[model samples]
Target: WLRGTRKDPPTLDETIAHENKRQQLEKKPINMLPTSYGRDAAQGGTGKCSA
Candidate 1:
């Protein structure tokens, strides 16, 4: 098996900071709106037609 180049492991402080950031992101509310696709003029998307 071919092994890729490995990087140094994160320090204690770095690991703690990463975990804290992950937790903060996990608690954040995901506010996303549905989008429209295709050439349908009625549906909202790129208003103008493509060449």
Candidate 2:
């Protein structure tokens, strides 16, 4: 089923799971970048790599 088409609020577990999944997906690209920018600000340089 489509997530947005649901009528009822998600359960606590479902909500948390969805949040975790979203966070993971959001972080994956940064973590996958060929740099330590995800862990260190200094190493990230100008931080315009992704821009």
Candidate 3:
């Protein structure tokens, strides 16, 4: 039968470590608007306008 032949998967600790590494790899820095944009409306290009 396949039951005995199949090996056990990763342990809890191993699984957690893998997930943590994956999250770190997927993380990225957030982009914020420059303060200068607040002073000049023309400098800040109009983003997607809805009707």
Candidate 4:
């Protein structure tokens, strides 16, 4: 099962720190503006064209 290659899981402190960081992220607003990707004029990902 490749258990020897698997790294140890995060400790309690590590997991708490991770959760706190995630909570901080959840409090922030995500920039959903389409200034790239599915709205790039050059790339033509305006949702009308196929990938």
Give the per-residue lDDT digits (tens) of candidate 3, residues 1-51.
113354877578756765575455346344535453333334322221100
What tens-digit string does per-residue lDDT give for candidate 2 at 1-51? 124456787688776765675466457654466445444345432233222
Task: Tell me which of candidates 1 and 3 scores higher on lDDT.
Answer: 3
Residues 1-51 of candidate 4 have per-residue lDDT tens digits of 113354887578766765575456446556744454334445432232221
How many pairs of residues collide in each model? 0, 0, 0, 0
Ranking by lDDT: 2, 4, 3, 1
RMSD in order of candidates: 15.1, 11.2, 18.6, 13.1
lDDT winner between candidates 1 and 4? 4
User: Which ten-residue region of model 4 has the weakest summed lDDT?
Assistant: 42-51
Where in model 3 is the C-alpha error above 4 Å? 1-6, 28-51
Ten contiguous residues with the weakest lDDT in model 2:
42-51
Question: What TM-score would every model get versus the actual structure?
Answer: 0.44, 0.43, 0.40, 0.44
Model 3, 29: alpha-carbon shift in Å? Answer: 5.1
Better of 1 and 2 by lDDT: 2
Off by over 4 Å in 4: 1-6, 30-51
